[model samples]
Target: MSDDLKEFESDFATLAKLAVQQSEEDVRLLLGRLVRKYRQRHPELAEQLNLSLKSIQTRSGSGALRRESLSEQAPGAGVPLDRDSRLELLKEFDDRGGMSVPLLPSGLLRQVESIIQERQARETLLARGLAPTRSAILVGPPGLGKTMSARWIASRLGKPLWVLDLTTVMSSMLGKTGANLRAALDYAKRHSAILLLDEIDSIAKRRSDESDIGELKRLVTVILQEVDHWPDTGLLLAATNHPELIDPALWRRFDAELRFSAPDTELTVQAVRRFLGPDTEALGQWIDTIATSLKGRSLSDVERAVTTLRRGHALRHAPDEELVSAMVGADLGMKSKVERLTLAVEMAKAGKHTHQEISRLTGVARDTIRKHAGPSPRRGRGMK
Candidate 1:
């Protein structure tokens, strides 16, 4: 290892030793003092160090460490560890194997670093008498890694991330939906965990839209209030493909707004290589072409296209030429709702058929046929 890496390893070893010798409560006190001191002197290090502290707490506890331990610790009155002691403890514990924060790949590491910096700015703002906003809105098309980013944040911060499943929380009965949301939010708050409201626009959509029901409106209101009242110590992230559909109030409440847009040609090429593996050279070229063709498409669409192409190749028992031809045909046009709806209607009438068969009959792209015939029922018909 290089000199810097060797130094880091040594420091981490020392920190681990110190951490292992302390009781869980003692560690919390030590960490609390460390967090306060770090925030005062080197605020940039606070988020990363705080995350490590949380990780140590989680791993050291008998059960899961209560969120209250971090947020509701007795006001002042803990270990007398200062910045140097905390740093030494961190160095000792750096490699002791208890939920060490996963480092992002090199390309993404810079972005993660920027997020840490932004978090420090928010903390500084809060310290200066501004109300600290704990909510973040990660707006992106599907599969651009918005959810992954949220999980990464939780991992980096040594906090458990609770992904709110809309289906579980939404209810048909009056008042039940709001109640469910409140219960979930309270659980998250009490745990001091990261609450990820994935595809939030589905539940917290604009009230003015004709399709929205009164129950949804109440749910949105409750959600907005919860976001407004969120504890500064915890993180709340909401991710959506359709940000325009989100309620205005919710939009304004977020302290940080990040957009995970479609990957450019370079990123798409890298992703194709990452997913398809290096040996598939012809397949990679086909993906490049598809990526070019689907310029404005979401990451989900790119993945779907790749899967369809691979399946088509596999089922045909075809060589590279045939596989390339099939992929090229599918990549001819943009994915369209009308095309999908038409295929779904045709499939309903035709009964179950393979993608190629559906494509032949409906004159639609084979990829489109595959997508529409997925697990979901057709637009107007129930699955039999």
Candidate 2:
């Protein structure tokens, strides 16, 4: 086919894919790009496309979206903003078909999946004289996938996730912080959007604290009332690293509370495989050792470490065994002497490296590895 025809086919396929995914914003963006691309050779087609684009923009600006589903509207449609700073109080993410399932433990994964299934079958519950879970609080340390899980829930339900930005909601002007928060909450309710209050403890501190100003106390009051009366049509999620700081009253209002912690051994191995991406096959032999060393770390840390390994191997031509050895050696400080010796034995038994190499990597002497795991294989069998 001709170059022009190939370009046209590619653009057509992209538009079809976006439409199927119900990605309105991406469809509009692609259409706008096409209009510019064909303006010279296909002026009439470009003009027609431009007119259709303008009509959609006019509808979006004229409040037609409120009458329709909020998820189908643009990312910025009707988002509340702070009065003094004019910063957006809520950040929008319409993940749709683009989100990845969060890497959570089986128990936590079931809970997250239950939330999604409940939302999907909400009408059936309502007909049976029941109500779906209206709100939940995710309590955990940072980098444990609370925010990502929220996004995944929204994506599975084919809706948009609106996250409350506490920095923007806390206005400089007196009494304005409460108003900003209220406005954002009201907007989310009006659209029935899945709303996430990230780092909720920042404003929902203990109400009895004598040092907290009246405005903060008022903010907590607002959240308490909102959480209690949040409608079944919308799902409200709050995540916090410091659950202790949250008021006791606020905790009671939530329908459920989900707790997150660092990855365990099994989940750590899964995270290593997922983070390894295309390099998983080439480095499969070292994944167990990597996961053993990275156990108890957050998924974000695993991703960073795996990404660094890939970059080193791809750019610097580092051997897989060398990269794995360096990573294990760096993490040896966190392991006890017995744990180090155990890892050394595993490496030695795998026959992928010499006992001396394992000793150096794990701080366990070669004699200890030999005593525990027998003799290492020929050096030619493993990485040179």
| Maximum-TM-score candidate | 2
Candidate 2: segments with Cα more than 4 A from true spot? 1-75, 171-174, 204-211, 333-353, 370-384
Candidate 1, superposed: residue stretches over 4 Å from native: 1-113, 117-133, 204-217, 278-287, 310-316, 333-384
Q: Count residue pairs with overlapping backbones in model 2.
A: 0
lDDT (C-alpha) at residue 288 in model 2: 75
Per-residue lDDT tens digits for candidate 1, residues 115-214, read 6555556434433444344688888666777776776676566554667755445433335557656766766665555678877876754345556577
lDDT for model 2 comes to 0.78
How well does candidate 2 match the true structure in TM-score terms? 0.75
Report RMSD for candidate 1.
Answer: 15.8
